[model samples]
Target: MPQPPADAPALAADYFQGYSVVGLLAALGVLFVAVAFGAGRLLRPVAPTPEKLMTYECGVDPVGEGWAHTQVRYYVYAFLYVIFAVDSIFLFPWATVFAAPGYGATTLVEMFVFLGFLTVGLLYAYKKGVLEWT
Candidate 1:
């Protein structure tokens, strides 16, 4: 049960000073950002034109209204892609772990169980005709 020396208080104070320094740096960063934005607002020219206000896409002049109906199939395809992509990512790590020494039979069974769930989901999507592209 040895007590800390008198210098312990100075060491603790220095530790807290590090946080104070970080806080000061963060405050200065915010101040600089605000000043930059304010200066740009005050010094920049304000000019509004029809072309500048129009929505531009791929360097082509937009011909139709900005608000337009989109096909739901594209969204469904993107969602299915995300789901399978994430599942494949998890499979890689699981495969690596399954190959390790202590994780032989138990890991194999568990992995099959996980794949069964993924298979069920894929089958459900297939049954609903979500996998078809037309």
Candidate 2:
């Protein structure tokens, strides 16, 4: 193995110093959370009541079963919403890149390809009646 230069020790020390700062910050964050939780526990009242002990759900008492069946259509709707939301996010970056010289045609074609995939998925969902409210 080749011997490192005299400056190598200084470089290594500086590299480790950066990591030491990060470690110190992480330690301080943990200590702060610990102190806050400890203070809350020591200062808070310990009175227990039936109302406080019972499980609460959206200001209403939990009914018969903890597990409730949800329709699969709700999940499908959420998935479709996420797909279009992400597509809209991609459009911002695509539009910026498309405005740059020499990238107009390339970006346009790529965006169309992306939109085509989204269109296909939407069409498939429509054909399956996933878009129907009935």
Candidate 3:
């Protein structure tokens, strides 16, 4: 069997050289990040007073421990907002596809199915009194 051509070895060497270059750049990036973090640590002043350590709420002194009981209604409202927001997000893409040919009927049917699921979720929330504010 004939030995591989000289250009073949040259190409392999070039590939390995490219790998080393990438490795070197990655190492340099990590080194620079570490040096920056170390410089910030060394140059930055360390100042921690009681006032700074205390929890601040709208510039008012915290009266009690940080832990406090929160109403569950707020969470429910947030979840409902998220559900509707995502539904709206889906509408934009669906609108784009709805304008395209060959996707109208199928997309419309699928969208109704998706809306049905959303309606079911909303109905469940309503029956559970999650929609009520008081």
Candidate 4:
């Protein structure tokens, strides 16, 4: 059998061996970001005005109140897009596992049930006319 590790040197070697490169890389990343930010601060002009403080949109001057009304339909459409995107993320892994020998009928049924929920959601969105471009 091989000899057991020593108290100090072996432990230090084991610990540093795993983390020394990672620590060095982390330190280098911090140093790089710090240098870049410091350089920017040193080189940039220090001009502050009311126009700079105001929010700029498409080069248009400010009009009326800062707050504007937003359509709820747009939010619903975005939320549905997110739901489908998340659904696709899960489906890719499931499709990979599905081809494996051990998982057959059970995986098929589960996937269909998962798809059924998505189908219902899609139908609901269709009924609400959320998919319309006009």
> For every model in order, what is the number of clashing pairs?
0, 0, 0, 0
Off by over 4 Å in 4: 1-12, 116-134
Q: What is the lDDT of residue 18 in candidate 4?
A: 75
Which scores greater on TM-score, model 2 or model 3?
A: 2
- Score residue 25 of candidate 2 by CA lDDT: 100
RMSD of each: 4.4, 2.2, 4.8, 4.3
Q: Ranking under TM-score, best-scoring first?
A: 2, 3, 4, 1
Worst 10 residues of 1 by lDDT: 64-73
TM-score, candidate number 4? 0.68
TM-score of each: 0.66, 0.81, 0.69, 0.68
Please report, in order, the local distance difference test score of every candidate based on alpha carbons: 0.91, 0.95, 0.95, 0.90
lDDT of 2 by residue, 1-134 (tens): 99889899899999999999999999999999999999999999999999999888999988898888989999999999998998899999998999999999999999899989999999999999999997
Ranking by lDDT: 2, 3, 1, 4
Error of 4 at 87 (Å): 1.3
Candidate 3 residue pairs in backbone clash: none
**TM-score leader:** 2
